[model samples]
Target chain A: MDVDTDVTSGGGTARPWPIVDINPEALAALESYKKRDPSKVVVRFKAVGNAPIMKQNFYKITASNRFQAVIQFLRKELGWKAGDPLVPHTPPRFASPQLVLNKPQFTYINLAFSPAPDDTVSNLFKSFCTDGHLIVNYSTTAAWG
Target chain B: MSQYGTTRGPPQAAKDRTTDYHTALFRRLSWEGTVPLEIRVDPNELPANSDRGLACYFVQAPRVSYLPLLMPEIRRFLMDVVFDEAASKSLKEEDWWFEIDDGTLLKWHWPIGLIYDNHTILTTIRPGPSLATTSTTPLRLILHLASPPTDKLLLAANAEACKQAFMGQLKEADFIRWGNTKRMTGLRKADQDGLWEGIKEHNFEEYWRVASKVTPTTTANRPQSPGPPPSSVSMHGRPPSADTSAPPERDGAYNVRSVPVRLYLPDGPVIQDLVPPLLEDGSPHTLAHFLNTHAPLLFPPQPPAPPPSRTNPNPRPPSHQELAYPLVQGILAPLDSEMAWLGACLAGADGWVNVCVGISRK
Candidate 1:
């Protein structure tokens, strides 16, 4: 279950599953990236993939809501308008509020994504697992700061 | 007569009563002046060099040694109790067992015996007696400060001094707290007369930490290289800070109290780099120096190979090339010009037959 959102979406893609449930903190973290490059976003989406994806019940990225549709969904979820802070001062680092898992061994996992990075920025971040590989539709990086 | 109780004044009456009660108490605990401390090595108490000395100060200079992991006040108390000129049997063998009431023990010091079966406890040597000669010992604990100490202080740097100081501290407090004296008292005794009233509670916590470091004189610290590669893959070698809780030992288990202590070691050309080599078999710095001096030497310069002369040629090949033409094929291998010397050798360049043994000498 998404920690931030109680809303549920169908397990697989309904074409770029609208970002109606994006986390507020995650939304706040992406403002600057949106302003800099609005067209193509190197975004991340997590679907219940404990099992593998098969073509029998196919899923793909993009629907009536294009990939950019997540941007507005994030804005409304986090209560933001354009010109909001690019990065929140404090990012949520924990998966749960209380450390319920105090075993001898306890660690955490997280989700992160970026808007389409320029060639220079793209080379620096090497993804390890799970890919939506950003589909860049907008290229206004010339004016990005 | 006594309720008017006898005619002795309260002050006189109090002194007389105390005198009668303590006449036999701590009979063995007397020192002309001050007493020296008890020092325990990791597992055993150190041999005492003097007959009537008190306080166990580290012999190594503060800059070159460790900061005393044992609290200084407890160390002083231990020396005062165990290093007494007369307390040889202050805390009789095993247990003399005293019952302490709760009141009127404004200040008192008694002998304590630690549970030697599961504990590392010992006493100081009187003169000719050595630590190896005794069966009692104590674990030495020193307070770890976040920042460094300002003035010169004894950090348990030397094995000999550290052991003695630790023993002395425990011995002193044993009488007043952990000793049988407190164990034998009635539970309802005045909260004030319990012998433990004289002990500094903060001081006891320090003793607990010290006692914890004494892990039954383990010989397990010897340095060893990584064993034959593990049967399964391991997630080691990753830099720390990535996971602060990662265990320090290769096997992921180590003594809780005895951790990776970062005490300053002696300075030397061989061990100058600040790497903490374990003091396992012997003096760690000394062992490092010896290894630096005697480890295996690397490939020696083949006497400059005397630059083989162009005029000299070899006698014969152990086997002729499968191909009829030997010279142009360059000894039957795909080696480039840079290895002409090898080609010359296989052409029996040095009068010896060359053969590729499939590179499987082992």
Candidate 2:
């Protein structure tokens, strides 16, 4: 039996891995978001000091897309392998502030502020952005007070 | 009153009651009297030997008129009591200029209060009484010669009058519409539109384009060698246009609201030029917008001109016409992120902004 696989030999019962008990409210919210146009919402990202340039700075994310989408996309773009920490414990000199593979801090309009990880892209953008486009500044630390 | 609950009032009685209410409302709503405008001047401008009674006279601003209509009255007051013979003669020729705190020179027609109102200068000054006592306070407005005043008497008189007038007015400005007043309430939708076509059409174009000398007196007096550097890379040294005040014409439209910006490219000569207006709603004037719209204009395709001849090895860098945009990809980085806002980038008194541009990889 593979350790990664969820299985019990004694009872022969199958267990679903990474189980989430779905709620109706959350399901309704997702369904509503699906009906609306996703392109209307755009998130604009800017590279910090000495950060590696992003191939595409402006990304159109659906209203339902979570903050995790951004982190995952960044990880994929940076070609970070699995088991690589999102928040690097050790300081790496070659590490670009733009591609900070650590507890990255993000600011909206003001440099000092950061949004919660659970915030939906559309909601966050609508609240914090200008001209229906949210400009997100990413840095390894809170850049300004 | 007792029978009113049981039965409706007669038609004639009801009509009389309504008429009475309307008359009372009309009386209250009618213009009562002229509002007293405060005429604050720089107390320092007042002559030390002048009558103490002159201070009291300034406090009584000519009422029921805006600055334009009231200017004649003020001029008369100045000519009669304050101005010397030469100063009085200059008034007739319209050789004088009015300067606001921000170095904005104005003519007689432009309303003085509007500048004070828009900039919130007086309010900022009034709060800190300690700052008021300082001797080296910058005078708000002065009526000096077109050239620096040679006559000591006239200069002293001008200073005295300006200070006296400024202080008097600041003491008690009438409850005038400074910001977001009743008129603004009517313009709620227009304000949201942000371009303010109404404000644009207020026929302020003439006044806004007040043609005085470009260089300040202080700067003009400075030694030639140590003078301000020439805006070498700027496409338009001085724009070709009738209106001296406006930035320049762009795409057949006059960009009246532009500020002079010096675009510093990496290891390249700085391109100093007026940036076009940020759209009314404060959207679309981003770094991307500048690159897309202006970069092409600033850096058009370089013509396949022959290489620099051996004799003239140092051919000048690409002029505005010769430069090309396709190879030019760069990110504009202001010192601070807020400088990204077009307004903040160049709202300085000098109307100049220094922007750093880094070449971007395709």
Q: lDDT of each model, Cα atoms only?
A: 0.22, 0.33
Worst 10 residues of 1 chain A by lDDT: A103-112
Relative to the true structure, candidate 1 reaches a TM of: 0.15
**lDDT, candidate 1, A9-61, per-residue tens:** 22333333233322333233223222332233243322121211111221232
Using lDDT as the measure, the top candidate is 2
Question: In model 1, how large is the Cα lDDT of residue B190?
Answer: 41
lDDT of 2 at B355: 45
The candidates score, on chain A by TM-score, as follows 0.18, 0.50
lDDT of 2 by residue, A1-145 (tens): 3563322222323332221222233233223323533544777776565444555667776755655566556545444432355656733323444344553433333232333333356544533455667666666454431
